[model samples]
Target: MSESEAGRITIDTSRPHPARVYDWWLGGKDNYPVDEELARKILAADGTAVRGARANRRFMHRAVRTAAEAGIRQFLDIGTGIPTEPNLHQVAQGAAPESRVVYADNDPIVLRHAEALLKGSAEGSTDYVHADVRDPDTILRLAGESLDFGRPVALSLVALTHYLGDEDDVYGLIERYVARLAPGSHLILSQVTQDLSPEGVARAAELFRRSGTPFYPRTLTEFARFFDGLELLGPGVIPVYGWRPDPEDVAAQAEGVVPVYAGVARKP
Candidate 1:
């Protein structure tokens, strides 16, 4: 919240936003009626929506913890949704008290809840950047104030890439961000995929498109392309729940299939 540029923030309740829709799926109360409507519609078409959201959250926690345990002390999380409990900062700082985190999101609602995200352990520092993921320069520049790019940092974009279509140069944007990181830095990502349930995923994509949000559900090979030059960690590019699952993730796997691909890689 402290890094936000001064301006009047506005919440557009007319159309559904991906972050708010995701919040609704996560059982958070920060979304509007339009967001809830879309979330319910997508859930009706794709029964795994809620489970996928939850699994993605777990994947993020596990990934951040892994990085923290590996001695990474700086984190940059883009497309950070609503202020969910045990957020990226909490998970990272929990593993390493001195972990520094910077969260970036374009949603006004997220900005309003930035104060909650800023509360980290006394040994660590947390900052929020009110910016879009497409503008990597702005985010990196502002986040640099708190994170040292000269050293290893963990960059996470969980359940976010699917919202950007091919026209957005998703891979190129990711490359730009990765190029700024030092060696040994980690890149954590989780994306919605159609490899598990093609029919349901297609229907869900259509629903999102009609609601004015562009959605792209990639196949396994396509999703794996995101880790091109990086070294993938163990359990490479598997289903969401299968990526270093904890007890919670183990139980979730028995519930249903979450057509999402998650992976963590290190810049060697």
Candidate 2:
């Protein structure tokens, strides 16, 4: 239930998985009934659970565009859930066709769909690693096969960090990966926060805890620490939909009460 075997993948439908449940929220068919069951429970607790999930994915799109437009050609994405359209590669390679991407996830389902993620541009490279975020050494080692650590890279951890509680040393773990990057390297992170829907988020967290899943939403201060030593990008640490939002939606969704906070930071 914690981690899947490397070569042998067996999905357990008895309990809910964070990735699968998230897939359900994203309207993907990669999830099971168990995932939907838990997802419903969460949705019942938080009315905007589905909305927040979609918003989070949009954040990924915008963030990747920002990175690509900034000339960051290498991308390392951890906790990559089911392969939805406009994936990291599609967006990054769309902007810069030569962009290389490495996707990592411990979920067996993600590995099963690795083929879809591997389809990168001929001018670029795409690879998937069956690993967990906690194992940064392995992730970085395998991802290095395609990406050049000597150059600027964008390390993206989208809608994923809240799974690691304080005891997991979220700050130290992230520091390990950022430490390996050269200057100008970027960190793209978006995580859920209780700032907007405190009560709803708390109830949802309790539900996840009872389901044997660890969900930890942090305060703005704690979340900002994850980007220490890096210069935060514009609209720093605001709601996921609020960061450099599209002109049309900026005023409308700007004040939208979403539960996630996103930010991009440069290593320099």
Candidate 3:
């Protein structure tokens, strides 16, 4: 576990963390040698790994915009990884300046960089909660301070659930989080799946396991189950790069075979 003191989180550079490694992948400078080592190893094993990360970020941009355009003005993004450009609040507030966002993550590095996530449009509000995804109740309680549970909230779990194995009772965690939202709330998710590259993805998962970070890439059907009891949006459960691909992003279009599955659904 990392050390924490007086609201200043001290990170453990001795090991690799998911959020920091993800930061490295996004070309952020917050990662350590351990993180870079793991990232490089995964990149070496799966040529599409880095591209998959970038594609997921692009999907986040499009999905946030979609929710905003649909009149949703609140966001609760858990496992918010590390702050890459166009963070959730930035995208949401850009479209709707009054949009409120609450970001939750367990990583100390993310907490250290929480300041950037806090900067939202003057009219909007952004707050960070340092908590693990497993504790949905704490997240909901703390987030309640900023968001209104009586209104639709775009709950984002992008590129997060694959870390949770079946034993983790992943569905229960998701359901608990969703159950707190008012009707019309949305669930946005993206997870790595071996459907496209079984061997390579499994190898990467083992590497993560050895590094003490669990990675479980679910199948397409398993990934879709996350949206159970919710109304799925059209063009559902497709590759991250395939969802609302930008014509201007020629590379995203060319890389339509990204191994991550993503979808957005609304609570009935």
Candidate of highest lDDT:
1
* TM-score of each prediction: 0.98, 0.95, 0.96
- The C-alpha lDDT values of all candidates are 0.94, 0.89, 0.89
Q: Model 1, which residues run further than 4 Å from truth? A: 2-7
Q: Higher lDDT: candidate 1 or 3?
A: 1
**Ordered list by TM-score, greatest first:** 1, 3, 2
TM-score of 3: 0.96
Q: Name the better of 1 and 2 by lDDT.
A: 1
On TM-score, the leading prediction is 1
What does the lDDT come to for candidate 3? 0.89
- Backbone clash pairs for candidate 1 read none
Pairs that collide in candidate 3 are none
Score candidate 1 by TM-score against the native: 0.98
lDDT of 2 by residue, 204-251 (tens): 999999999999988888889899899999878887878888764465
